[model samples]
Target: MRWALVLALTAAYPLIVYFSLGHVEPRYLALLLLVLGGLRWLAGGAQVVQARWVALAALLLAASTALLNTSVPLKLYPVLVNAVLLIVFGLSLVRGPSAAERIARLQEPDLDARGVAYTRRVTQAWCGFFVLNGGIALVTALWASEEAWALYNGLISYVLIGTLMGGEWLLRRHLRARHARLQA
Candidate 1:
């Protein structure tokens, strides 16, 4: 489906960059692709507004990060290119789905209400994390220091870890509530 294609493209970018550039680190590229591919998979499966938005935000942030990588030195061209791509990705995600669409999907008889709510909350947290990470990256790009890059990268990794934890928590809470409701 569309999600599979997006995931493939996301994975391909890093490989292409590594093979073509020959200077880019394979580990970094692989990590980026893995994160992006995972985000796309999550977004496609998301049934709540918050989860969808969070996945979208993560995707945009990842794309922006990739674009920024192309301009570590004094290169205005890569920055401009990345900026445009970021805008495109942002607009596409926003226009693609509405909260109503997610809500409708969640309203199915077989759907667990608590699970949907938790998904929404976790997605919102992810959106916040990505926004913060992107802002830090932008600031670091302007300042241009090795310390800045290190700090930004570290923060991004922390955000991703936090997101995973939040997701797990949400799933657990949802299951607990579902169990209680069923008992009642």
Candidate 2:
């Protein structure tokens, strides 16, 4: 139930920005971000990463909204989000048990050396993907048309992520089957 609300909020974020910009006061949008941040923190179980990033986002949006009163912050929101994700996934590498491995463990807690290695590599791939995608988002926000930025950030980027996720799932299946065969 909570997850559903978060998903709904996330999906509507760009649209909110699109309609709100110029039509609404920037402070209202910033306040909405702050509210969303609170909801997100609660929905995410208040994980440290989520709390910190969401807070930072709310703060940044508030500052930009109040002082700058421009659409640039809305444009940049996705990039900040990407940066947060990159750090979340990338930093796990240092803390041990990469983010992918941790998630995989929820399904297969008895992961062997090979599974561990595979998940680690997958996490690294995700990190690299975030880096590239975030760069594109940054470029789009900074230099592209508003429509183009909204298209990429609001829609096309999710498609690309879906493609990446689907591709990774397919590869993981093949690799898992190969590993099973080797064991057999």
Candidate 3:
């Protein structure tokens, strides 16, 4: 029930923006919705440490991107929506189930210490990317033209996706090497 609500909220974001402001390009909004919906679906099935971390990272990135592009002024709604999102992200980072927990739930647990470490590394990297992009957006919002916001959004989207793919590849290599060492 809760998951459904979360998914609905995420899916409804673009529509909310569209109805409220009525100015966003439809193609861009559609793209954003498609990416977000895909991420939400992927997250539901992610059981591996790396996959879960990447999914979480993607979710955070999607939420932040939505907030950045929202047409309504931040001040009007008393900023509650943004506040709730930050709280949810922070709690997920702090107390949410780890990949190990998910594995345990599945009863096929192969507790690899390296996998745990890699998950942590990926999570930290994602958090770093989120913070860095968020900071840039803030600076642009304050000091630069609003036009810069779109550029920041595009750059962050491309760079974060690339970083996640690269990180996953490196983690896979590390896992294989560790497995080979154990066999040897």
For all predicted structures, in order, the TM-scores are 0.38, 0.90, 0.46
Question: Model 2 off-target regions past 4 Å?
Answer: 44-46
Rank by TM-score (best first): 2, 3, 1
| TM-score, cand. 1 vs. native | 0.38
Query: Residue 98 in model 2: shift from native, Å?
Result: 0.5
Stretches off by above 4 angstroms in model 1 are 1-110, 154-167, 170-184
Q: Name the Cα RMSD for model 1.
A: 9.5
lDDT of each: 0.48, 0.80, 0.48
**lDDT at 112 for candidate 1?**
59
Highest lDDT: give the candidate number.
Answer: 2
lDDT by residue for model 2 (1-184), tens: 8668766776677777877776887766877677666766777663666656666786777678767777777677778778888888888899988999999999999999988998899899989989998899899888998777878888988899999899999999998799789989
lDDT score, candidate 2: 0.80
Deviation from native of the Cα of residue 176 in model 1, angstroms: 2.1
Query: Comparing 2 and 3 by TM-score, which wins?
Result: 2
